[model samples]
Target chain A: MITSPKVETKNLNLYYTENQVLHDVNITIAEKKVTALIGPSGCGKSTLLRCFNRLNELIVGTRIEGEILLDGKNIYQNGMDVVDIRRRVGLIFQKPNPFPKSIYDNIAFGLKIGGMKNKSRISEIAEKSLIDTGLWEEVKDRLHTSALDLSGGQQQRLCIARALAIEPEVILMDEPTSALDPAATFKIEELVTQLKNSYTIIIVTHNMQQAGRVSDFTGFLYLGKLIEFGNTNILFTRPKEKLTENYISGRFG
Target chain B: MNIRNITDKFFHYFFLVSGVSAIGILFAIFVMLAMNGLQTFTDVSISQFFLSTRWNPSAFGEPSYGILSLVVSSIMVTLGAMVIAVPLGIGTAAYLSEIAPPFLRETLKPVVEILAGIPSVVVGFFGIVFLGPLIADVFNLTSGLNALNGSILLAIMALPTIVSVSEDAIRSVPKDFKEASYALGVNRWLTLVKITLPAASSGIVAAVMLGIGRAIGETMTVLMATGNALQMPGSFFDSVRTMTANIAIELGEVPFGTTHYFGLFAVGLVLFFMSLAVNLTAEHFTKKYRRYRT
Candidate 1:
């Protein structure tokens, strides 16, 4: 089955002041699938993920050329509200970044700011979001406690639930498990696979095994260019490009 | 011993002596205040000294050692200064940390620092010459020197300390928390009030307490600007005398060791405890905030 792209980029280019970071890249991210971007340090994979939500523009003197479309609408067009576009897309950072607030309020922050006013309804959505991320049972008894008191793994999951509470259509994870232990990393990978069934998932990772384990499609980025992109199994086993094969085979990163 | 080793040992003991002498001076001052004030404490019951509102220590017939009015004026002036300084300080800090462009922040920060560098006597002089008359004219008062003038001057003096320390606290809030708030699509103002301010709450609290300390212990400005009235202040517009001003006014040329002289020492002791309490509270809050910073 051929699925239409949920997000598409056309000849996308990015620059920080005078320095170019991404160049002439075209890619399509399909709906309801996990697409992983793999690259070395400063390879621009994280920068590309930030582009989806226009987060890159936060830095002073950042300039973007070409179009990034979400569901066939140009996100960068004049008159398109940046805040509204950001609400439709959620982002999870490399480290667990829960607010210095109670566990329940952490999830409810998005709901409240997004204008969901009913008290009971906000709690209802917060509870559901926690359950969806498999954190409801562990945290149910102490939802009023500070979120920082949670274990590192639990904090990361709480962050995921925080993103999910807004019910965004697309979720972006940028090395979400890089700070967790092996066991915690495995649990997050499991959650990402489960999350793929409902929301379009785009992840940027440095761990090859994580990309292979959780992703359906993979793109290997090198020096700000997409070297190869294809089915995950084929990309790992029989890469089409020399750089992709070298990277997957543990050659120079 | 070799010259280097001898020099190192000499320097180490020199530093140790200097540190010990500084602490010894503080202990000596405390002992002096207690010894000198002890006579006054016995002459007038402690309750009478603290509770009596009429503070006439040099009356021809009978002297009254009441300091309740001084305490009340000190508190009123400190609270009034906090009312003016706290919001202005924190608002300027937030603007410097989050809103202002780099060039403007750089330009304005040093201006606040210079305000702090101006001597308290000079500030008191400014109050006497400018702020006092202006306030008197505006309120149609008999004289310009009053609690209101004192508070306005002290607020200006406290601003630099409060704004600089608070700016550091707000800026020290981790980048990740801000990014997370922005990722949630929350606006800049909401994120500032809800996330950054709460995270920096303890530091901001410590800053305010320290500012209060500066306002309460300040002697020159309050003494010059408050008209040194011994009567209890009926309102902010009325001329008032704070504890600092009382000690300052009586410390000079009162016959040494007379009950009146000892009474001033007792007031000095009270001032000491007040500043000590403020410093201790500030330290407690700063330590509490330090734990979460990591």
Candidate 2:
């Protein structure tokens, strides 16, 4: 017996006002795997990631045509709560966006929204999630401190911990490490590899080497089209498309 | 010296002179008021002026000239106006900056601001002619002009100041903060209450302070609608007088060398001090918020 894909997109098309941003696309994301979407700037990688959680709904005049399935259920169907969908499929933004609140409160926000009223249980879960992201030891003594005071790398990890506290099945990261230094980026890459054991992960990144290091599967997008996709090792070693070859080889963006 | 050095020194002196000149004018006005009014403190006991109620400076033998009742009346009217102005003004501001659609916002913002540009004398006339009669009819009172009517008119006059300032404060909050809250799956109302309002609280408080200062100093509206009565007001329906109103009313009657004249000056001095304190407090809080936000 085979399990269904964790997430699948069927003939997805997107437009911003009159300008089309994403062409007809079809892809399937497996469970408990790390998939990276690599492309140049303005190539619709981030746009495609945003489609999974409906972040693009905030923009006026943006239209999407097609269907997205998560766990064999259509996400855009009537009576499906966007908030509930977002809670199940969490997103970590590129910039670290910790609330101007206490570090503890930042992690507990989603749990509170999900109606977890027991204080002790919330504290336990917050601690567990923070430790899972390797930030508990550094911030345990000062969990009440303002999140803005944390270092850039710590803030990014805290955001990941925040997303984890919601107990999402699939985590979507939009270039989560592009804003960080090399050391911080390496740490985040390691965390992503470790997280793939239990959670299906999708990431949009511009770094070819980082993608090769962390991702098991990679999809190359250019001009809103998926040019090529395959195992990370195979794609880097032998890309079928010339555009993918040129992009991975640094000939042009 | 070099040309660049000379130009820089010239510019620095120009800025210094401009700033000093502004403060210097304020100091001059305060010193003048004090010099003209301080004699009242010496001639009559300051305690007598503050504690007594009788305000008949031209009475038969006693020559009573107490202003305590007027001061009390002024506080009462200003407080009443603030009770009506602060909430309505701030609510209008929130509606304009946060909730109103773009087309409605553009229309309502200017309409609210136009309330400020109307001359105070026109507001005074409208209060006496229209609002005073309507208030008197509603309450079935003997006189139309009263403290309640005055407060209502002043409240309308203060609305524009509060709305404009508070709207600016709300608009100044960073967009990223709102986006972060939305991404957390928080609803619009909760995000506004928990994030946007708290972040802009210092500015809102400053707006309230500025509104209070304007209400306290307003003269023509209070003078016309309040019946210029120098007795302590017992209720919202009773006629009363305020510090600015009393000064404006009595300035023509009091002789330049007399105690009554100096007492009016003293009232002006008190108004100046009150507004100065309020402005300074608002400035302090605004600076504190800036430090944290930056």
Candidate 3:
């Protein structure tokens, strides 16, 4: 497997004020493949995912050192446009956070923000994205209705559609199914499987079984350090690190 | 009964009495206003009382009880006050909640609260001595006491309420909404204007409504700053009298039980309804805002 990485982090370190969270993490994420980050609570898995899109900069006192390169361009460089970085790498949160807008507007929002002004083009992109997320049929007749009216699963799918509508190269999911039920989680897992062929995905999930089911590569983090990084099947079964073994076996956090 | 049951009964009766007394006071005021003001309808027709622009309570032969001018003046002053206050208040709130550094926000919030605590009479005095004279000079008016003067003072008085409530609303917008907007690559200004403000709109609307209620019910400031002239204002600078000003000025000198006194009471009743409408609107919007939280 000699595929070049789509995203690479070189000695990435992140801090919130004086408290360091992620320390000297280095990994290369292959293109059009799902890479899952698994760790215990407060282990900085979500923080790492947010760093990909520079979402962590929103919090005051946050500091990041080292490089996060997207397509070989260092995103952390002074001249790098953060908005372009975010547009290139879309993110969805753990909880479904659809705007309190019409269902149609939810998908249209990203397009509009990305400067897609033509109404017909926006509608076409919105419809295609919704269909890709498999929500168009159920909501086609009621596109004008409030997005809040949708069920939690539908809303999560809608959020995915919103992220996809921007046509990003990579998609980051921060425990996107944790708040959902098992059925909805399965639906999302299946959707992730289908989405990976077209977009590079980096998912942060606590559910180990889900990481195995949906991801190609799995990275196990412990106390802000990358403990193990390998194929999902190999890491789950034959982890090289003791901490990874204990964490995966549920022996200890 | 046991001692616990007896104590419970006593407390329940006490609570009931307190609640009834509060309601009773409101009932008593309504009854007083109705009993005194209803008779004005006999001397002056309902249409004339509501529609006529002329208000000459001490006319030589016949007194006119028309409050049209007063109502118009009240509306003009309130509208003017809102026009001045809304932008300033909301802008201050946005800056405090979203943009201002913590040190600046902490220093300014208490200053706004203290502004709310200033006595209306003191504000009225400032309006008469300073604001009125300044306005008169700037606009080339004969007198500074006018709707504009009253509006400026009322706007200052209303600022604290609007800023505090709107700031709270802006702060309470879930961090997730902001994150989502930011993840979409939208800038802070667009995020505040589009997502944050729209999400917090119900609360902000309630804040503005409450501010309007305060401006409409304010008496001393308007009475002292506005010329208290019985005229429908043609412009913000024109001398005029608000409903509260009319009631305050007449209630002091008009003999009790006279038609003049009753007319003032009628104006009070109308003002009460206007405040009630404002409060109900505020309440409605507040409830609607809460529905968005969950």
Candidate 3 residue runs with Cα over 4 Å from true position: B1-7
Number of the candidate with higher TM-score, 2 or 3: 3
Write one digit per residue (lDDT tens) for candidate 3, span B1-294: 899999999999999999999999999989998888887776778899999999999999987888999999999999899999999999999999999999999999889978999999999999999998899899888899999999999999999999999998888899888899889888889889988999899999999999999999999999899999888788988888999988878788888877888888888888889999999999999898888776
Backbone clash count, each prediction separately: 0, 0, 0
Which runs of model 1 end up more than 4 angstroms from their true locations? none
Taken over the whole model, the C-alpha lDDT of each candidate is 0.92, 0.86, 0.92
| Model 3 pairs whose backbones collide | none
Error of 1 at A120 (Å): 1.3
How close to the true structure is residue A242 of candidate 3, measured as C-alpha lDDT? 86
lDDT of candidate 2 over A1-253, digit per residue (tens): 1154799888889999999999987778888988999999999999999888877887778999988999878887888888888877888889888877899998887788778999999999999999999999999999999998999999999999988998989899999998999999988999999999989999999999988998988999999998888888999999999999999999988
Q: Considering only chain A, what is the TM-score of each predicted structure? A: 0.98, 0.97, 0.98
Error of 2 at B19 (Å): 5.2
Q: Model 2 clash pairs?
A: none
Question: Compared to the true structure, candidate 1 yields what TM-score?
Answer: 0.98
